[model samples]
Target: MLSEMKDHQSLMAALSENVLIVRMLLSVIFLPGASAGCGAITPVLFSTTPNFMEGLSGSCLQIPCSFNSTDPRYDITRPIYGVWLKATTAFNVTPSSVIFNSSKSVNIYQLEMIGNLTEKNCTTLFSDLNTSYTDRYFFRIESGPVRATACADPLQITVKDSPWSPSINISGGDLKEHQSVTITCSALTPCPHSPPELTWNLQQDSHRQTEKNTDGTFTTKIQENITLSDTHDGYIRCSARYPVNGGNKTAETAVTLSVSYAPRNTSASISPSGLVSAGSWVELNCSSRAKPPASFTWFWNSKHGTINVSVGQVYSFNVTEGGEFYCLATNDLGHQTSSVIRVSIKDNQVSGFTVHIILKILGIIMLYSTIILLECWFRFFKKPKMKTQEPTYVNSEMAKES
Candidate 1:
């Protein structure tokens, strides 16, 4: 019993030394494996590999991988078999999802296992990539006491169709109505075998083109010359289409077009009438047609020329005394002056047919008052005098005749 305990202690000491050596090697290279029994290190180990890979769905992709192991025997004659697999969970240390068994299965992809067991290089490649290739692929190996399902760092393969969306760029910063602008739309075609074609939903005609990059990708573009108007101020979309197996896949991008323009057909008007009256409020409104709503500036013309009085779309003032009023409409693009409108102020707060009615009513009241005065004089002093005077004249005539 004592001899067995001594042997076990020696074995533990040797494993401790191996663990320390492996921990040191971790700085330069990744040595991943399990302890062989209680006294030995893992004979087979998986080396470092990429964690992510992206590929076109209809194209081919290659993942460079390699592995290493600690063999005490240093026996190169013994066959070291390797296998590749995919993992369901990224956090799993060992996975059973099998993809290619290098020992038994036929190597359809030539580079599926370019790494020789003797050389310890385990690079892999896949042909005719599709959605099925989208997974985290891992590496496994079989040797002496080292048997692992998923021993290497898995590679996350991303298989996709064409690019997601296109980008549209407008050359002019502030565009105006009737002005022309250049619109360029671009998209990337990952699968060079069938490059995407660019197109636009423009009111005017446009030109489309495609460029092949040295990285085996294609960039599609379109140049559009648009004559902007009020009707063209809205959302515009650009689309790119790439050929697939059965049909073509399309992607779109939308952008807003804001065409700034100077004001047009600007005019000023008064609320009540062009002729104003004293103490009455007169409202002035300035209006125009513009991309962005126009701002109005009220100006009063005098001997010294036009002078700014107010700023807004609407202005109100007491018609204490009036001369002439006008407004100018303006925006980021340009400005426009409205036609002058003359406002004549009367002495009293009366205007239109209202003045005629008031004057007629006053005239009628004066006429009635004059008639009453005359009637009072006839019924009082004047009537008495006439009756008395006529009697006196008759008596005088009779006295003369006797």
Candidate 2:
């Protein structure tokens, strides 16, 4: 009986051991997972490239994100890729997305990897970035399972300030008809990389301009030589342009130019009402109008001569004889001649009659004067001679009587 009892105890112990073994196997198959194990994937480390920078319009922007996985769990089924996108702003209503490749292994997002990535920085640009595209945005890598994420600070395209209105700077105000003029356009821009071009909206007839270098401020001047015409008046415009944030920016200014010169209008006239007499002192006057003082020269009959006069419209001189007298006036522009004037000399009509009358009066006076002289001679010396004669006669009678 003792031997049988011992045998049962042994059998029971063996059965208990077998049941414990089965329970242990079940725990391994269907129990909760361990917090740390061999198949568990470690978090991947990732960093965004070009953390901070700037870029221009219509240019490519690069966003670099490098990732490292310790468990090597990434595959074609699920890629650790990112989405390059744009945030909504005043000009835009929806957020736009540009997908980089679905590969988790690629390190760079070039211009081809995303929608027109035109800027230099990690920004994806559309063909036309309107004013509504100004907002904040960030890129995200896949998370969990493949389970690694890197977020770059919000990215935004900086719109450079457009250039200011262009203005004209001239060296001088006055020019001759076919003379040259120099004009410079002033540029106002805040963009650091690109320069702007200048052009004229409305100008006179065809002209040629020369470009000259200014200081290091990217300023250049142009010179133009042209014949001045009436069409060069009214509003004139100068314009400048440059690129900005996937778009174009332009500026313009309006101005009016007044050109002054000499010999615009010229004229001359005579002072006397009728023709002047030959061998008489007469005045020949000449005058002209111009910006500066106009020069005057007198002419007899297309013959060159000079005249002195005051600084006024009229120039006068003594004319000994007049056939045809004229004057030539000149200024910086050109010269012109005055119309001809005729002059004549006439003989006196009553001159002979006046001389005959004076001769007759003189003859009458001479006859009266001769008669008075004879009377005076008879009264004085004639009387004395008669007295002497009477005495002689008395003496002769006395002698005869004696």
Q: What is the C-alpha RMSD of each candidate to the true structure, in Å?
A: 14.1, 23.0
Candidate 1 lDDT at 54 equals: 71
Which stretches of candidate 2 lie above 4 Å from their native place?
Answer: 1-166, 169-177, 181-265, 271-289, 295-311, 316-323, 328-402
lDDT of 1 at 68: 64
lDDT of 2 at 374: 88
CA lDDT scores, all candidates in order: 0.70, 0.48
In candidate 1, what are the lDDT values of residues 1-402, reduced to their tens digit? 999999999999999999999876663354333231111233345556656667666655555566765545435566766777666543443434666767866443333565676777666656667777687776776665555544435568788866468899998767778788888888764444455777777743566667765433356778877788777777889887766656677889999888777788999988898556678998999999887888889999866887888999998988766778899898887899999887777654365468899889999999999999989987887654434445444587788998
For lDDT, the strongest prediction is 1
Best by TM-score: 1
At residue 247, what lDDT does model 1 achieve? 68
